[model samples]
Target: MQGLSAWRDDRCLYCDVDLSLPTGTVMQIRGPNGAGKTTLLKHIAGLSGRRAGQVSWASTDSHDDRDTFTQQMLYLGHLPGVKSALTVAENLQALAACRGINLLTHTISQALNTVHLGGYDDMPCHQLSAGQLRRVALARLFTEPVPLWLLDEPFTAIDQAGVRELEGWLAAHSEQGGVVLLTTHHPLALNCPLQFLDLQPIVEDWH
Candidate 1:
């Protein structure tokens, strides 16, 4: 359960805040605009440097392995990390390759279908609508198996159905003993137990 504890300094975006997220727990970081929720998520994802406090992962070994930690986590930012010139299937294939996971065309199709983008698999990302593009970014959740998922503003441009689909995926991930840390302004309706970690109070000055 116990994992990382992170905080910030004067120049840090989120300011002074520390949090300890346990494993397999769905923690929601809620805040107003410019509260640094995304910044915090990036820190947890190991995409940003910590200015003050440390982000420590629990390990039984004598030393913490950065490569292992990176491999254990997946960070989905607000922007869809896709190539505009590439087809939907190609994007997933590239991501899987970068992560050292081999993805088949059938698996990519299934992932696209799970996100309700089955018919758009052959289309380039630039041609897809904003919602469909978001769906394409989300399709990776089904095509790959990663233990920890760190998502920032995942519900930004999706419709109600997309939200529900994402909720279902999150529930399934948590059911399999996976950890999820995300930032969302919209409320989520799920069948499993959930926890809310309000970051609104922590970064009030930024607004």
Candidate 2:
């Protein structure tokens, strides 16, 4: 994003940040509570509509970049966005359907297995543990491949093993020339360079 900024309610949470990130970049968003790390990522993900300054993706012209950006990006917000009424398999299938992806039964099974929820496909989401629900949401990471990833508080409710596995998945995505932007309180263990931007009212510039 070039000169990307956003405001929440009337408070400017994100300042103008002229970023020229290349492929294979892994960026970490940092700040204290209510510092706008989530707001900043939301703006980049096109979730925050009221944004200031110009933002562009790659070499695309600003006037005609929305569709291109949407096609290339995948965003996972703080909430797992799972449906409590639906079973684990149904939730994944629903997400895939929304993204215009057709996931075979076997593919979904593998994704559940990868997240260590191998036998929970038929279980209702609300019946699963918080960590299990999070894993079900994270199954999208394996369901499809996109160029950009925007994840907020991805480590929430995940255990040590899951955290390590998530870091590995993110690292692998970066290694494949995908750009990943994530917000987390815990430290990351990715093999790629960890670019950080600490959001503070006094600190407006991108680090």
Candidate 3:
């Protein structure tokens, strides 16, 4: 699979900017608050309708191939998609089932351990601290292997150590030829070659 072009329309928040990100690359979308970072991520994740332009995947011209695109991508947004009522293990298991990945007990345990949540897997997410919950969310990175990762504000609520662990995981993912597109204000301590896209330049006109 190759990269795709993401174009914007006049009614779109980003106006006329179009970005083409190469495959197997780590693309960072940087901007101030409310600069459409989340919007761009939503579009890439196939959660939002394109106002005018399109996002193509693998050079395929068929819009019916969205499922094909979705299968190759794992999207982690501002919300961890965790249920406050469920245990950490249950949340991961549910997500794995929905994504059609068979998440084993050992895999869940190892993922929690990677995110430093080994002892908290059986606990309710509400019982965990904000940072700990974020770690639990990030633990999915270890349990699942997808080609494209789209994360919005992944560093939110994470401590320094947790941030380091997440960065290391991302670096390793890119090294294994996986592509990552994320929005983060925190300076990343990564060894991989990163491409930065400043979304601030694409301002919307309210007129």
Candidate 4:
């Protein structure tokens, strides 16, 4: 992105933001509360249009080939985005279907197991705890074939073990030439180097 700017209630959340991420890279957005971390992610994911900036993919403008870009990217927001009444497996299937992805039964089972949701696949999501529900959402990552990931607070409500597992997944994705951009408070322990973008408040000088 270049010259990215956003406003909320006439208050500037951020301005003149610039970023670039290449393959096999992992970038973390760091800032204090209300620093527009989520806003930046939303813009990159094309979820929010109230911003001034240019987002490109593979040296081509995103606006020029939005359909292709959308197919290559996956964005996970704060909410789990699961149906409460659906079974864990069913929810995963539903999410994949919404994205027009076809997941075989074994693929769904493998993804569930990857997030440590193994035998719980048949259980109703409403019966699962908060962390379990989060896991259900995270399982999507394992099944998604896209190379670019935009995650907001992906580590929330999960245990230390889950955090470590996620870090491993991020590292693996990077090693396999995928790109990941995420916002999280937990210190990442990945073996790969992490690039950072700190969104300072508008009151502060930005360099």
Which candidate should be chosen as best, given TM-score against the real structure?
4
Q: After superposition, how far is residue 123 of candidate 2 from its true place, in Å?
A: 1.5
In candidate 4, which residue pairs clash? none
For residues 147-180, could you state the per-residue lDDT of candidate 1 as single tens digits? Answer: 8889988887998877887898888888888888
Q: Write the per-residue lDDT of candidate 3 for residues 1-207, one digit (tens) a residue.
A: 223223455444565556665666898998887677887788777776553356666776325687778777888988777999999999999988887888889999988888888877789988988888788788888777787899999999998887887888888888888889999988988989999878764445669
- lDDT tens readout by residue for model 2, 1-207: 566777766667767787666899999988898888887878877678678766677777444767677767888988899999999999988988887888898998998899999988899998988898889889988876688899999999999999999999999988999999889998888887889887876444567
**Worst-scoring 10-residue span by lDDT in model 2:** 54-63
TM-score to native of every candidate shown? 0.85, 0.91, 0.87, 0.94
Report model 4's TM-score to 2 decimal places.
Answer: 0.94
Ranked by TM-score from best down, the candidates are: 4, 2, 3, 1
Lowest summed lDDT window (length 10), candidate 1: 1-10
lDDT score of model 4? Answer: 0.90
Tens digit of lDDT per residue, candidate 4, span 34-100?
Answer: 9999999998888875788899988878889998888888899988889999998888888888788
lDDT of 3 at 142: 76
In angstroms, give how far residue 137 of model 1 lies from its true place.
Answer: 0.6
Clashes of 3: 0
Error of 4 at 174 (Å): 0.3
Q: How many residue pairs clash in each candidate?
A: 1, 0, 0, 0
Could you tell me the lDDT of residue 19 within candidate 4?
91
